[model samples]
Target: MTFAIGIFDLFTYTISGSIYLAFLGYLVVRLHWVDIGALAGTPVPTLIVFVLLSYLLGYVAYPVGAVVNRVVPRRRERHPRQEFLRRVPTAQDRDYVQADPFLLLSALQLHDKDAAAEVTRLRASGLMLRNCAPPLALGFVAAIVELFLSRTPAMAAGCAVLLAVGFFSLIVQARRLSHWARMKTLELCFWLPDIDERYRVDRNAGGGSSPNNE
Candidate 1:
């Protein structure tokens, strides 16, 4: 599962990085920094160079993802844990209110392999969508620039519009996937004997519902 998650992350990075690289490549060609004709003639070597550069840019693109994340409106400004507590009923119990949802979920995963796998899958996909947003935004900008530079303004305009729509949609889907993963974690925790016992103890000690501290 860990390896699978790492591969998914790599794939996300590569995809986003490729877009960033393409944007840079366009600028380089436009500025005459590299000869496009020469690159085309040495296709194999150029492809190898691009492949290596994409992986390197993949690592660099994380900062862009961080910037994009800040620009995007999330459920809460603080940790997602706070949002989970506010939204998830199971997280409202006294025991869970003060507990870290991620930690609890990790503990739950130890005893349930299937639940662990599912959560991992959701998280990986959410991360991919989230990371992709940055490059898509950059692609939109690149397309707009291309509109001014290209002879076919209509095609460039259409590409820009599609990139704009895709960027927005990825942001929405990323948040949804993250929320779904947290909800699934809480739902699965409901069946865990240890979690049940914790709830039982909290109810017995508190004798009522706990107020949301946030």
Candidate 2:
């Protein structure tokens, strides 16, 4: 269970880690600087070069995505609970959503005391361990495959774009987590426990106990 949870947490970074390698492989093909035959001739040095370029390319894509995020205005959202409830009507649905960090945020919003504390614990664990490091290592590993395993230019470009999308999605999730954390902190200052009333209303409306009751 723990290993599965950790992998779920690292999913985005894991998926995106190969962007650098794919981009590097694509560049290698486009520039005509080195071919498979030459790489075989000088395997070790060529691999080292490819590895560095792959990691560097991943870093390069990060700033480009950041800049684009800065330039674009984020859409305003309100009544998040209503939105969440609309989508997650069953305990089964909530269970699946729990894999997402958004589950933590939703718990805070719903005044789930346990979830709030878990968020703080997660925050203290170090971002590199919890967030960035997995992706960095994955990127390096992907670079190896891109350099040695893949050969087609089109496939390389496709992989690069897919990884870029995953990388950008992780960036978006990080921003949402930050925003939700701030909201949770502010709400803490003026804490209110409305769970009893919420439960009462749910029962009166012929609904069963809320999923959070678990």
Candidate 3:
């Protein structure tokens, strides 16, 4: 059961991460490198394959990473739990599975809720906003306008209108990211282990024997 759930949880995490990476690429590539219009002419099947590849990469990246960990050994990791939370390359994340079989699944859901709430908080503060909203909404409206842009048509207007709207979302999302980053930092700080001998227990664990026994 843990194996099945871990696989599924890891896949979801990977896909989300992959999409994040792809979206980052889209922003840079569309802005400076590739012309979206030119790319649109590519064969549909190939495009579909490319998207599937993105999702597939996301789905397997973590599990493959975990499996790799099991298959290899290395210098012992310091702060392995933090490393796991950071989602970097690790030999395995079986530690979490071992700690609590349902932990991975719980983390996924909790992370989502925590992320959304953090974003909303930032939005209220005018720091971060959803970046794609404007462009997407404008594009939708443009499609309608373009059907009649010659009359009331906005064939290309959607893209331009959306560009402006999307900026607002970018601000909100930025704030959200910053807010969440701060929270994550705090959480890590809270969970960080302390090994100072000075802090070790000074009390006897009843090793002297109870007074009654004495």
Best prediction by TM-score:
1
lDDT score of model 2?
A: 0.45
Model 3 stretches astray by more than 4 angstroms? 1-50, 53-151, 154-163, 195-214
Model 2 bad stretches (over 4 Å)? 1-115, 121-130, 133-149, 192-214
Q: What's each prediction's TM-score?
A: 0.68, 0.32, 0.27
Q: How accurate locally is residue 153 in candidate 1, as Cα lDDT from 0 to 100? A: 88
Q: On a 0 to 100 scale, what is the lDDT of residue 91 in model 1? A: 54
* lDDT digits (tens) for residues 117-198 of candidate 3: 4433433332212322323443445445555644544545555566545644553444445444333433333322331121
Q: Write the per-residue lDDT of candidate 1 for residues 1-214, one digit (tens) a residue.
A: 1212255555556666677788788879988899988766676667766766776787777666656766877655334456656776555663544444565566677879778768767766766687778777877888898899989889989999999999878877777777677667666765677665675565678643432211
lDDT (Cα atoms) of all candidates against the true structure: 0.69, 0.45, 0.39
Candidate 3 positional error at 7, Å: 12
Q: Candidate 2 on 1-214: residue-level lDDT in tens?
A: 1223243223323233345455455567656876746555766666565545544444445444445445535565333344444544543223222222344345464766665665554332222122443343345446546755668756655665665555556545555654444344333422335533544465578655233200
Give the C-alpha lDDT of model 1: 0.69
Q: Model 3, 178: alpha-carbon shift in Å?
A: 3.3
CA RMSD per model (angstroms): 6.3, 13.3, 17.5
